[model samples]
Target chain A: MPEITYREAIRHALAEELERDENVVVIGEEVAEYDGAYKVTEGLWKRFGDKRIVDTPISEAAFIGMGVGASMLGLRPVMELMFWSFATVAWDQIINNAGFVRYMSGGLINCPIVIRGPANGGTGVGATHSHTPENMLANIPGLKVVCPATAYDAKGLLKTAIRDNDPVMFLESTLLYGNLGEVPTEEYLIPLGVADVKREGTDITLIAHGGAVLTALKAAELLAAEHDISAEVVDLRSIRPLDEETILKSVRKTHRAVLIEENKPFCGVGAQISSMLMQKAFDDLDAPVLRISAIDAPAIYSPHLEAKQLPRPTDVIAKVLSIC
Target chain B: MPLLMDTAVTTPNFDTAPINQSLTSEDKLRFLRDMMRIRRFEQGALQQYSQGKIGGFLHVYIGQESVAVGTVSLMGANDHVITAYRDHGHALAVGMNMNECMAELLGKATGCSKGKGGSMHFFAPDKNYWGGHGIVGGQTPLGLGLAYGIKYKGLTGAALCFMGDGATNQGAWYESLNLASLWDLPVVYIIENNQYSMGTSLDRSSAFRSCLAERAAGFAIDWDTCNGEDIYEVRAKTQIAIDRAHKQSRPTVLEIDTYRYYGHSVADAKHKVYRSEEEIERYKQNHDPIRLWKARLISEGVLAEGKYDEMDAAAKAEADESIKFAEASPWPSEASISEDVYFEVDRQTIAGRTGKHFFND
Candidate 1:
């Protein structure tokens, strides 16, 4: 076992997969010569050479559609987006071509491509550059969306995503890229649609995905230390093939749950979870399934205001306190 | 035969360009038959659409037959073909049977896409036919990717990507051109400049100098234009681009000037609003690819009088049989609604067995 940053974990996954499969190629802007926009793909390009680790012009739709076409021909492309916000320009390629090609082609072909990038809102990058589109990606029937919150999960999930025989939307948080955690030297895979119970408690349940999992954990810790309450923290690693089994299990024990995410309050990931819990575990819940998201507005440029716009531990704790 | 008769001796000064000098008389006759087959199949599809048997966008490639027939005639073992929505021409030219293509348009389970992809997305990877993409310029990048994969695998072939004149205006087209030229990908962008994009004429829609393919100059890509009515000229001009792709791993732009008899799609009824009766009559009398090829073959003694009538009759009979097959084919099962979304789930792999994949009531 070794402790590495979340960015390194992603890079490790890329290296391992690229070594294991000759068909795997990492393509994106600044991925090869510039190391990577976020440095997650650093050094792999030098090792794999230009063919395996390719760079592209800033035409998102063109290159991304090319990746879809390449994937159909059996080359597994791991396309990196500098920011998840930039993905909107290529939504037709991502959602229409990659997402629907399998179903539309009647399974005659498979688009085995992974589109990975940081999706977040806390960094004051403004509205256009800080979109958290996990819900948008997950809402589509054909795509699988992943948002890993730690180095261990990032390494495991990315490896699985590369191997999955469908289009997978691997959403990362730029804010969490350097966060460090222990990852095993041996290869392991965290299957998509499986939730991880980070902390066990009895009083209430706090559910979140991606970087919001850290906030949920922080809130859980504070609940125990200050409010004399124990809260369960559940991390929904994958959004689409949702692990309702784990979520309901945690909620059944705690009898209360609060969904939190950095995505906006309007029809976000939390909205889906809330609907799922209400439909399936309505009897077990002590109160209505509550959700706290980043304030329902454009990402403000002011750093202080942007920080306030993101979901925080205090907000999660306050939501839990009101219900419990 | 076209409903409007050739009452005027308005045929242009169409000359003979050798039809792939390597091709024998049998091969030249086969080209005529293939083009006639496309004409009949499109007629069947149009008839079906009028009867309300097919739904959503039926873009019949009636007049522009020689471009697909000629360019696809150049495909080698590793070469591929992909086109936009007006794709029945390319699909037939690539050797896909009338049965599966008709069944697909009919939305039946026995179709090529099993009724999942209607008219716009037919695929036959086994035959090296990548797809029948629907978007204007969407398939250009996909063509580049197909070429990229061929180059990556060290295979020798070109990907012939066909698009309409309208696709030339897309920003993605320029982006794809830039990438293909910068990377030296083996792709030939064949523009079927059918004189109009939907109802708007090419000159009105495209603001390019001389021709649409001329825009390739910005990317330092080689380009040329050919009169698409002559199959000989079509094959000869197309071969240059395909060779550039296969030998040099470089991209080229080829604009084939052709015409379409119908509107943009069967759904588009305003095709008559923009172009006049005489203009349409002129194309039908003078520039129709099938008519020109038929005339060229007749003069060359490759086709005798009444022989093309026999071939056209045979193609119509085959199209009729395909329509019967489509009408008799079963609709997809309700349980199949969730199938084919994931290859792993269909195969039931260990990884795919981990979670609930498809959801239904």
Candidate 2:
């Protein structure tokens, strides 16, 4: 087994799927000749040719709809939206058609498509390109939303998403692309709607997803080493079907829960999880659940403001320590 | 021989006749029967809506029956079709049984969409009918993409995407048109220009009200405008467009100038508030295509007047049967609510990360 960066893992998964399945194709603006905006699809066009790895014109609605249509016709199309913020331009196809078609069709049609792109803030990409829309997509009933934290999870989850017989919104982080982890070379898949306990402890349970999961893991290690506080870290890989059993069971053991997310503090995935915990596992708790989230402001272009907006490991550690 | 002489006398110009016209007497009867089936089926739906048996926005395509009938007749079994809310006619024309469509309107378990998708979301995958999308201009880009898929898969089939004249004003329509033309996708974009977009006439909503075909030239694709009232002309134009799209891998837009006799939906009064009653009467008298065709059949001795009566009776009986079936059908069960949300898959286990390094075992 070899260690690979998150970006390389994504590229490897795409390249391998292209090699394994002739029906798999990638389409997006600059995904072909320019090697993708995030370089996750580099060298795909050369190996698969222009037909498989297509560089579409800058028309998100048309290209995304084309991906949906391709999925209906038995083609596994992985379309890139470049930035999650740009997804609004194709919301009609994504929400009304892609998300609803299978349910509306009564299982007659399966939309086996993947809309992959970078989501949330870290770089000073500003308000336009920094908002995390995972909560909005998670609210939709018929869609599966996956946000992987590490390189290994990215490759495995993406491979599973491509093969899954439903439309999936696979969210990646701009900051985590360069982060490295050991990814298996052999074919593998990660089933969605499952949670992974990154680090186990008994003090408090910290639940997070995507980039925030990494921060929680770091904070868990720091808590164990410094204050002898054994904190449990849970990575919620799938957002829609939030793996409530794992979170509830972990909270029952620790009796204290802290949710970490990169989105704004108000009306985020944190709020939904907090409400679910209160309703289902309130009797098992020792302290009220606390949520660590970004400040209620748009991500600014300034580095200082951007840094202040995101949830850091120190913030997660403080939240856990406060609960403990 | 005597047989050849008899055949020559009764050839009926079948070669020169349009695709719909080239059909045998049985096929023509079947087409007319399907049109009547849709008409009667929608009438039942309207009654249901008024009585509260059905809910949601119900858009009926009554007078514009020829567009769906004429165009879908030229499409093969493997071809795909997508359309806007006013879609019952298109659904029935594409071989969806009247009973299933009626059951769908009643929100029953036996509906085409399993009672999940009401009238506006009708889907018959077995017939290759994609959907009855509720959004006005939403299907344009999707239709083009389906066409792209067909071409990408090296299939000879084409996708027939139906939209109204009002949808042409949508930005997605323009973007999809540009992409379809640029890629030379095998798709026939049919504009069911029914003169009004929910009481706003095309003259008021569209700047270029004369014809949508001229506007399509900007996309560098050839377009044609046909008299949607005349099923023959619609059939001919659609045949030409479908042929060009499949053979040349070029997209074509056929703007069919049609009319809606009823209000936009069951909610509004059927009376003409915007247009005059006299204008409606004039269209009914001068351009009633179904009546005109029936008259032509009788005058040319192709079909006896008795045959017309028999077909009408059969159509009425079919409509009555559909209503009975729909009324008796049961609603969907509550247990199956979340069944089709997503395709379920088995879970996978991951190797836990040790505290040693980012990659090493």
> Which residue ranges in model 1 land beyond 4 Å of their true spot?
B1-19, B359-361
What Cα-based lDDT does every candidate model obtain?
A: 0.88, 0.82
What overall lDDT, based on C-alpha atoms, would model 1 receive against the true structure?
0.88
lDDT of each residue in B330-359, candidate 2, tens digit only: 889996675677655211122111110010
For candidate 1, the clash count comes to 0
**How high is the TM-score of chain A in each model?**
0.99, 0.97
**Tens digits of lDDT, candidate 2, A71-148:** 888999999989988899999989988898888888788788999999979787789999799988887877878899
The number of the candidate with the highest lDDT is 1
Cα shift from native, residue B46, model 1 (Å) = 0.9
Model number with the top DockQ: 1
Please list all clashing residue pairs in model 2, or write none if there are none.
none
Model 2: residues >4 Å from true position, as ranges?
B1-21, B345-361
CAPRI verdict on model 1?
medium
Interface RMSD of 2: 7.9
DockQ of candidate 2, scored on C-alphas against the true complex (2 decimals): 0.38
